[model samples]
Target: MAQQRDTAEADRTLKAKHRAIWASGDYPSVAAEIIPGLGALLVEACGVKAGDRVLDVAAGTGNAAIPAALAGADVVACDLTPELLEAGRLMADRSGVDLRWREADAEALPFADADFDTVLSCVGVMFAPHHQAAADELVRVCRPGGTIGLLSWTPEGFLGQLLTALKPYAPPPPPGARPAPLWGDPDHVRALLGDRVTDVSAERRTVLVDRFETPEGFRDYFKERYGPVLAVYRAHAEDPERLAALDRDLAELARRHDRAAGSGPTVMEWEYLLLTAHRTDTSP
Candidate 1:
């Protein structure tokens, strides 16, 4: 009993740390530039329809939620960061779409069971420290026959490789924390979802990164706006040489993955896994 309580306390501390890290940066700027493509994919893949009650869990700045609302669905956008939720509210207002924005954790969503027709997360929920609890909340809020759409970075993908490159400079993750890239694995996802969902499937897709004139330019942009990247930079502020080495390594990774050969701006392809599943009916 004491062990369980200790574990729970540890999880809460880790989650608090995650929330602070994410809120430290201006993620909306980065999300604005990248989330549209993934949002469109989720809309189509989930077969979102008018009047569908949609929940965008771990929604960052209303990327998928705002688009889902524009599609005529009733949307609720939930995120742990209040700053990001405010950004999402502004974005929805500018786009002439109404969305219910809530500050909530993915692992313990405040919504009731079987409440949504569709649940979507674009490169979001994978970062949750407690993957199983996050998965359970996702399934719990989705109605039977409802669709759940998720986009995650594969271990072999650009974003995954970037994480690997940054690891040498970053602090180790908390004990018992699952790596985010595991969400990209079909088998792992299936195991996570278990028998709670049916018709589970995964597809590999490529999303093009914004073109950059040089690898350094790409690195600079992420450092300025991406939470995790910015956190790493801040952590190494006292060690200039270590930070420089980290930057160089990141730039090298970007250069190697550049899809545009000798161009004014180089395009980079980021591979991601698209997962879709239907919540199983519990009624006898």
Candidate 2:
């Protein structure tokens, strides 16, 4: 019992850390400027339609939720950080779409079992510290015949490599926490959803981002705006030498992946995995 209590406390601490990390930088800006279209992509892939009761888990600023709601679905967008949800709520209001914003943990959602006809995440949920727990919650809240959709950064993608680059400076992941990039792996996700979902389909896709004109620009933008990257910089704030090295490595990673004409703006295609499946039908 003592050991279990310790574990539970550790879990709470880690969850708190995650909430802080996401709330640290200006992520809503990143979502709006860099990866906005991916939300629409996930919504289309999930086949979300009118009147569907949809839940968007780890939905930062309602990226997918807003689109789903605009499609006429009844949407509830949940995230660990209330700050982000509030930002999303405001955006939904501006878009003239009715959306419910809830602060929720992907690993332990508050809704009743099988409450949603459609459940999805766009570049969300993958950040859950506990992989299996999150996957279980995803399957549990979705009706047996309901759809489950996910869009995540692939391990081979630019964002995945960026995460790897930042790991040297970032805090060690909590015990038993899996890397977020694995959600982009088809085989890995298949195993996670095993026997609980059916008719699974996975697609490898890319989104072209031209937000920055140079490698240094990309690195600098992330330094200022991206939460995970900024958190690492904060971790090494007193260590100027290490921070310089991290900056160098990040800029180099961007340069290596950049594809652009010598004269025009920098262009990079960030790879992602789009996976959709239906909850296993268990009706008698």
Instruction: Report the number of the highest-lDDT candidate.
Output: 2
Per-candidate TM-scores read 0.95, 0.98
Model 1 residue pairs with clashes: none
lDDT, each prediction: 0.87, 0.92
Candidate 1's C-alpha runs over 4 A off are 1-5, 261-263
Worst 10 residues of 2 by lDDT: 257-266
Q: What is the lDDT of residue 132 in candidate 2?
A: 92
Q: Model 1: how far is 164 from its true place, Å? A: 1.5
lDDT of 1 by residue, 85-171 (tens): 988899889999888999999999999999999999988999997789899999999998999899899888999888878788778
Candidate 2 lDDT, 99-187, residue by residue in tens: 88899899999999999999999999999988899999999999999999999999999999999888878778877999899999999
Clashing pairs in 2: none
